[model samples]
Target: MPITLPNGITAIELADDYPALQIETADCSATLALNGAHLTHWQPSHTAHPVIYLSPTAILQQGKAIRGGVPLCWPWFNAHPTDPDSHPSHGVARIERWDLISATVEDGSAIIELELKASPVIEAHVPFPFQLKALFNLGQTCSIVLETTNLAKENIAVGGALHSYFSLSHIDNATVTGLQHTPYLDTAARPEKSAVQTEGELRFQAETDRIYYGSDLPARIHDAEWKRSIVVEKAGSLTSVVWNPWIEKAASLGDLPDADYQRFLCIEAANARHDTRILAPGSTHRLETRFIVENLS
Candidate 1:
């Protein structure tokens, strides 16, 4: 059954038979859904068409909807670099079903807690015994807090990220500020050298993927066409992943249509190859990030 949380946030209940969870916020009338705990939709209003398209067809059956907002791709983090046992690319938690343990509203924000336990399906991919909780608060500002507690007796190396696919009116009309004079990994460069170059504002041109490390600067995404700016504030997680699949790679991911690539950008907080945290037995680690939206016109 779907229950109405405090501050007028409604949460759709999850049944063991299905893999769907819905969170609706009153402030912006934003609705977010999780299909098998993978991001299904995150848009402001129902009448407003998704800025990003999840499927090529309409009427997505069996919990498959048009995912047009931020998708939280967590767990094993990214590709393990030819390592078979280092967890799959982007982890197993994306498809794993997370449980909703508690829901509360505080300070005009709706906080919903979700947990993932050691299940048969999850154990097949990630054999670690652990308890993970993701607290999602949606309101004046959207925030997600991920807390993981190890249940096993031994230590475990953990790597993960909250993949947020932010939609834009147009790729060419947007720019990412606050990254001036920062060192970044030039993915296009062979052998991937780290160099410090002063690039004023991020632009979409060619296949770009870089991990900006040791930076706590607030990443702000501005869409000139839409006249909107999304300011990202972070804590616990230091690195940010900025990428746009562009034209070529977009055609490769057959699941995504060609035009969809021009409508969205992936800005994620990730713990990838460079920096990884190893949590000890009975130890817990927390990562937090906030997204504040504003009209810049």
Candidate 2:
């Protein structure tokens, strides 16, 4: 069923089971998929370029991740905390179809909520069961709040992130701020992982993958070529992962263009690695993040 909204836009079916919800608000325009409650696009109407970067070769399938956009990583982050060989890369949340809970336009902003309940398939991968909900606000300050509550009788440790892929004019033309002196482990570094302190505005030169901990400051990507800056702020998150696969690694990704490495940067608001959250039974943990775009002056 194609549901029409108050703004006269319809959420059309993009797949047999997934409906791609196109949103047009006064502040911006965006698209979301019910599958994983994944946000695929978001651009402020005033901006010249798309704020959220989506890969050109991104595959839109039922079970596969869309490669780009804002993929929700939950229950676990990266390889399984316990089972690295067999579990999903991020978690079970992004691969499962979430049920629509509500959708409404509030003060010219699109507010949508989607829920996911645990079942046999999820149980097979994760021992603990959970009830999850994702709230999206596509407007001036694009926001996403992920709520996960443990359903089992015992406490459960969970990790998640709003893995945001941001658009940039070019890799060399951008620099990251607000994470100065922050401690991070460079997972892609050679001779085992290297723990280093960030100095000044971080610039990318190669395949970069770092897990930053103990930081609550807003990370800003200053894009000189695009003439804009992206500010990422978060709450209830203690970890941030910054990455950009330069040339060789980008060519190896089947769902991403080879040159896309110069076009995007990922500054994620995450509770990952050592920043895992523990939720008691019937208690919920909310991971919230907001994206604010500012023109460079």
Q: Please list the C-alpha lDDT of all candidates, in the order they appear.
A: 0.65, 0.86
Please list the residue runs of candidate 1 whose C-alpha ends up more than 4 Å from where it truly belongs after superposition.
1-21, 34-68, 81-87, 106-108, 188-190
State residue 83's C-alpha deviation in candidate 1, in Å: 2.8
Task: Give the range of the ten consecutive residues with the poorest summed lDDT in model 2.
Answer: 1-10
Model 1 score (lDDT): 0.65
Model 1 is weakest, by summed lDDT over 10 consecutive residues, at: 57-66
lDDT (10s digit) by residue, model 2, range 69-167: 999998888889888887788887888888777788887688888888776767777888778899998887799999988888999999978999999
Which residue pairs in candidate 1 have backbone atoms (N, alpha carbon, C) closer than 3 angstroms, thus clashing? none
Flag clash pairs in model 2.
none
Listed per model in order, the count of residue pairs whose N, CA or C atoms clash below 3 Å is 0, 0
